[model samples]
Target: MTLCLLTITTPSAVEDVIVDWFLEQEDIGDFNSMPAFGHGSHEGKMSVAERVTGRSRKTMFQLHLSLPTVERILAKLKKDFAGTEIHYMMSPLMRAGDLTAYEA
Candidate 1:
């Protein structure tokens, strides 16, 4: 199987649409999310803390999926959130699951 890892990050405002997209996928069995924040710049606009600390709140969505499923998700994200500020990546998974019963 074409096992892999996919992750996406975006501002909190887009959480609803992002979540909806994930929910719509039937092939993707499971995924996860966590609170995260990072330094970013746009339109030359920045708060004092954002300038000095260079930090902003963000939500990260992660998916463990096969190549085909990942491709479909990418197409949806590209079409649904075109021109929006978002970040994503995919990586090959060597192994996953429990230490003794690891599946590769």
Candidate 2:
């Protein structure tokens, strides 16, 4: 199985919901999330405050999983979070491991 990084961005309004959803997924071992700002004129997506600042509040979730697992999770996300301004991207992971375990 090829390892890959999956990133999902969502409106701040549904950040908790997204987190809860991820927790329910058995395929996911763990994930990381942080508050972020999305900069773009996405039309009808930005709130008044966001429009003034030219960036919308967003929450980004990232996880490392196998290629097939990532695809399956993405498909499930598409069906469950439809119309929720949820966006995602996946990138291949060349390597991931602990760097301090090596003995000189």
Best of the candidates, lDDT: 2
* TM-scores for the candidates: 0.79, 0.90
Q: RMSD to native for every prediction?
A: 2.9, 1.9
lDDT of each: 0.78, 0.88
Model 1: CA > 4 A from native? 40-49, 98-104
Count of backbone clashes for each model?
A: 0, 0
Score residue 42 of candidate 1 by CA lDDT. 59
Against the true structure, candidate 1 reaches a TM-score of 0.79
lDDT per residue (tens digit) for residues 1-104 in model 2: 69999998898899999999999999998799999889977735677887998998889999999999999999999899878898889999976656887554
Q: What is the lDDT of residue 22 in candidate 2?
A: 95
Q: Which runs in model 2 stand beyond 4 Å of their true positions? A: 98-104
lDDT tens per residue, model 1, 3-95: 788988887777887788778878766678888876757514445876787777678988878888889888988998998667899999865
